[model samples]
Target: MMLRIPLNLGLLLLLCAGGATALAPAEATGAPCGGLWARCLESKCCATPELTCYEKDHRYAQCRPTGNCRPGFHHEDPVQTPWSCVVLTSPAPAPGPGPAPPPAAPAPPAPAPAPAPAPAPGPAPAPAPPPPPQQCVDKGQHCVDWAMAGECEKNAAYMHEFCMKSCNLCGNLFTNSEEGTAAAPAAAGDGSSNHAAGSSNAIDSSLRGGR
Candidate 1:
């Protein structure tokens, strides 16, 4: 019974030590900050009322008064963390589990990636070289030359007829000037031959009458 009493007492003291470690100061002998845990801070030069136990790191860290917090003289907007240095202005209890912080505001939908600018319009491609001129098909040199001189555009039907006839004629197309010159000389020669034949016939007729 005496042995069990002492063992129970030793277990109680061990549990007490573990609980004290949680609220223990950073300068407490063997206690070190681990994981997301931090040890309480003890006021060295500052008073307990003017100071707060903010565990800055695994090691006991000192923070000078920044004068941002009135009368408190510490960071006015202090970051909340396990080991943040803070001033005891009010109780300013640890933040509790509340809303999840709104999921970072959805990142603004990535801005839709702006469409690529359209290419600048170039000169209309030289009108496709005018489709090779329909009159050029199966046409002779003269016909092609006349058509290119815009004659075919002036009268397409007339030029098309002319092209068919001229291409078939190949090279025998007689112009008006050549026909007129040849006809004048041939008509004069025919008249002269008829006159000469008539004079000879008259001479033979007189000779036969005398016989």
Candidate 2:
């Protein structure tokens, strides 16, 4: 039995180089092909073999370079990286943006330490200096008269020590070592000579009276 079917000119079957009729393949534009860095599906197919497909996760995947370059980077096609690949940044999402951070709080000022105190008056004046001590002076006013009357020769111990200025022994107070040695011996010798001379004069006077 022969099954009859009407043929349309536009839907005609394709012919092969072998002179035989064959079924035609589906059109290329029938299913969409991804471009470079374009979103992809589980099939992971791309428009060109240089641009391969990769699945980032179950929900996210994209078409990227088949070279060593990973995500978050890029490279030049015909220049420096003609054969190799660098990192390729992923495509952005279609959703809205996220929220921002909170604002910072203000700080307080620091205070000053110890307050200024009142200063005291200046220091007290220094004390006055004491009066200078008296210089060396003779003890008695009769010192000069006694020294001149030759009392120093008779009483050398007292005169030389007490009447130092009159005895010409000033600054040698209370001392009679040298002056006494000279005066004492000479006074005793002179007194003996005067006694002898007076005795002779008395004898002469007595003899004249007898005559």
Candidate 3:
């Protein structure tokens, strides 16, 4: 069975629902220096009865004393100052409810997975090849020449060691003897000569069964 309510009653129900949604009961306009008032003071300038003016954003201002005012004091105002300066008509009772609590902040999201482990250490470096015999021989010659040029003791020692090793390997021992001295100069003056001598010595030493 279909039951139809009176049009007036239906309309009244709708109006009631709309009124509930659209109009919240008048909350107390709140203390004069309440939320909106505080915000307004924060956003604009205000003056106190003492004929002092200051920026609302700064919170307080110095008020110069008039004939009937306090001198050098902070004042908060809702509107433009000087003209707006007026004694409070009546003390506003302390507000029953404090400022509405600020909205709760949202929680932070979890961090993403850490990046994959870095690639494994690269392969071990290749072993270096042995230096050429000729290069070693050349180093020895440079050492000897530097010594003969009156270089420092340390340099002389190094050169002596280098040349001896180079010459010995090629079966030509470097000594203070006449042969060693002559050979040292020849090796320094021309590397080709040292190589030729080293080659000949190597063959001769081999034939003579030398170390």
The prediction achieving the highest lDDT against the true structure is: 2
What would the per-residue lDDT of candidate 3 be over residues 1-211, giving only the tens digit for each residue? 2345677778999999988766533321231232212322322222333332322224333233333343233355344434333332222334578889999998898899999999999999999998866633545436445654434244546654565443333443346466775566566657756777999999998989964
* Residue-level lDDT tens digits of model 1 in 75-179: 533543343444422332345688776666555666688899999998776555555533423345576446444555576677666664332322243224656
lDDT of 2 by residue, 87-195 (tens): 2233332356667667777666677777878788789898888888444456788886686567777999988777766666643553457766456446655776788
- lDDT of each model, Cα atoms only? 0.49, 0.58, 0.48
Query: Clash totals for all models, in order?
Result: 1, 5, 0
Against the correct fold, how does model 1 do in TM-score?
0.18
Model 1 Cα shift for residue 95 (angstroms): 9.1
- Number of clashes found in candidate 3: 0
How far out, in Å, is residue 142 in model 3?
22
Per-prediction TM-score to the true structure, in the order listed: 0.18, 0.22, 0.17
The order of the candidates by TM-score, greatest first, is 2, 1, 3
* Cα-based lDDT at residue 81, candidate 1: 31
